[model samples]
Target: MAAPDKAQQLEEAAKAAEHAAQTAEAAAANASGNAEAATAAAEHARMIADQLAVIASASPISDFVFLLTIFMLAIFVGYYVVWSVTPALHTPLMAVTNAISSVVIVGALIALGADLSQSANSFAPKLFGFLAVALASVNIFGGFLVTQRMLAMYKKKER
Candidate 1:
């Protein structure tokens, strides 16, 4: 058999190399495109998860209102104790103040229990309302005791 020409061998070798390089380039492009798409999809999923977390962590407006109310009760109790400690205040004022404080507590309990049974439009408002009211009652009762003690101390001083 005649020896293959050197020129033909060289040409064949060049063609094979070109074909391999082209295939490699195409494969690399495909891999890079898939990676880019995967990265984008992952970022999108992470963003959605963050949004859901924010929504889950957000508190309702009613809950905020209830929390504010509890804070107010604490302040009220503090104010009452301060007032009861002063000796210049009269007996009638002390007695009326204590009675009024107790009455308001009963009113709060009634409002709270009512709220539990009746929501804005539904049959049940929320059970938390009752708990809030009960806690408020405790604050008022505690304030009254403090006030009574202060009054007793003042009366002993007067004698």
Candidate 2:
């Protein structure tokens, strides 16, 4: 009876060892799959980095061409938009443009106030800033005057 009990205990221990070995094998297989996926992701990131590097090194002429294309598109769009508006909406549009000109004035003032002690080539910034401020001021004042005149036309005349 004692020998039979000892044999049963040995058999249970062996089965448990076998199950543990199988679990370890499965875990190792999962780790290997994860490593392969990580390698693939790293390769994809490297490819994108290479593409961005090429674009960054593009020539100045290409950059200029791209900007010029955008500028031309803007001009055409602006012309169409202005022409498509009804005459009655022009006053509101002028007021909006005046607000935009005020933003330009703010930018000009920032440029004008840049520290001159940092660089000897400060004159160009000052000159351009002054011109921008002057032009934007004129545009704002003119737009307001036009808007005021347009609004006046709609008022009831005095007897």
Candidate 3:
């Protein structure tokens, strides 16, 4: 009876390990499928981005003028919004502004670095990138200074 019980236990253990192995394989397959789908999505996004770049380069002068107009409008809107914020909210606003300025800096850097090897039509983007970098730098530094000043106002005066 003892011998028969030990054999049964060994068979049960082997079956459990087999089931575990199958479950692991299924999980690995699922992960592989997810990875492949992600790769395909990334590739599609890259293709779309490439198409947009080409379109931007080939776009008409009116398109450029329209974009410039939008940029100008944005500046006006930002000015009004910033000026309207109350003193109590100014520091938080400045922090948000700094975060946005950081994003602008990153975009400017990407614009500067993009297609460095393309000799044709590269100068225009590079010039714009340089301007963007300069403007973002000023915005970021200025925001920091203003935030510092605002924060200072909150501190208790030392005896």
RMSD of 1: 33.0
> Model 3, which residues run further than 4 Å from truth?
1-61
List clash counts for every candidate, in order.
1, 0, 0
The better candidate by TM-score, 2 or 3, is 2
In model 3, which range of ten residues has the least summed lDDT? 77-86
What residue pairs are clashing in model 2?
none
Task: Give the per-residue lDDT digits (tens) of candidate 3, residues 2-103.
Answer: 999999999999999999999888766765665566566556555655665576678764666656655665565556555554455668878998999899
Task: List the candidate 1 regions with Cα displacement exceeding 4 Å.
Answer: 1-4, 59-159
What range of 10 consecutive residues in model 1 has the weakest lDDT sum?
Answer: 81-90
- Mind sharing the TM-score for model 3? 0.56
Clashes of 3: 0
Top candidate, metric TM-score: 2
TM, every model: 0.35, 0.58, 0.56
lDDT of 1 by residue, 36-104 (tens): 665665565556556654655684546566556545654655455444432343444456665666776
